[model samples]
Target: MEARVMICAQTFFHRFFMINNIAQQPSSVPAGPKRAGEPEHTPHHMMVAVACLFLAAKVEEYPKFLDDVVRFTYHFRHGKEATEALMADKEGALKVEKDRVLTCERLVVSNMGFDLHVTSPHCKLGPVVDAVLEVAAAEGRTDLVREHKSLLSLATNFLNDSMHHLICLQHRPTRMAAIALAMAEKFMVGKEKIKPFPRVKVDGEMVPWWCSMRIVDDDEAISSDMMRRYMKDFHSQVYRQDDDEAIS
Candidate 1:
């Protein structure tokens, strides 16, 4: 359930960033002098993130209360004592925080042009995984079928991890889904295991199984080198924090 909500929230943030032309901005941009009537301060990233989650909950039909969203976000950021104080409305801080979130929500809505629909890669993951497994099984890769649960779980984890990065924004939903499944297969059964799945001839060249599945258009077709690069970045970037947490 949380995963579903986060996926929606991530998509919302992606769209929000794009709409505001902030997606490609460098990490730190120098602020220009303020103009008359311009806001004294912009919304903090934390505030925007919380607001995105709050709005995404509604868009996804999960519908968490605003108070709960504010409270949990506060708790996650500031720890138990601060959350308790905020909940108790100490010095009217709770009201102030909620107001900030509301303001950010309005900003997000306005910038997004009120378009709330988000197509998540999770929607495409299931069918692609099933198709791949079916093809593998037909080719006598029975182990993949036997380990279906693990494969699916790992693939789903990849999809979830993708939310933390710009990967979803960089690739189409179907391509992301197919790459996630392929990554899962490589991790579970080794690279050689994937070679048995039949490829399709596209314009005198053989393409991977996913390309034939129409997971990506002919022009957007993924190459083996590209897959390797994605996998390399996924390992180096996405799972870096997980590795650190495990180490500590």
Candidate 2:
């Protein structure tokens, strides 16, 4: 169910910009957060995810009725609710959740400092990929770069999927793009790329991604090992069984 909500959240982000001119949507003015008690009936994570959908609707201006969003979310989350009508008279719980959604929306909008414009993975990651390629070339890995002609595109694809997870909100777009690109490069070149990088205490006996990727960008502040750790944590996140259903 979280997967479905996450997909919807990503959809809301994309759909908003798609409906509006790609660059025209203004950053949401800081409207300030609402002070409401955490919803007791539904999981806090569920409310937060739903709130993202509701907030996206308003910011993008293709407002989805709160009722529709509620029913849409509950329907997939609960198999029994799958056939339920959107009508308000059927059950008052939908209305309650609607209020929760609105409240949470306010909290999210305020927390985000009202920024609404979403960055494309390409735009966000292009520089990172270019920098990595430049580093590879300088390190005499141009042979590998030339062999992987579609490397950047492949990395972008991985970023597209990574955006489905909540990490986008947690980390900088460029950082995620870099990690995705590193992973792509790793896929193309086996462990042969691993170099002896500065070890981070725990991996003293093990070869970390930083050692493997030869990524030594000080500005990025994340070692390949840390990036690999993030990747491990990210992939370990709970995946929703109903993800494809939501996207479809």
Best-matching candidate per TM-score? 1
State the local distance difference test value for candidate 1: 0.71
**TM-score list, all predictions:** 0.76, 0.49
Clashing pairs in 1: none
Error at 223, model 1, angstroms: 4.1
lDDT by residue (tens digit), candidate 1, 171-215: 778878777777776665454443344555667777787656453
Candidate 2: which stretches are off by over 4 Å?
1-43, 60-63, 80-91, 112-122, 126-154, 160-171, 191-248
TM-score of 1: 0.76
**1-248, model 2: which lDDT tens digit per residue?**
33334444674543333333433322331122334783222225555667777766565456777777777777766655442643444445555556667876765555555665664444656665555566556667655566545667666676667666555555555566666666666655554443322232334554443333333332435655587666665555423432222211
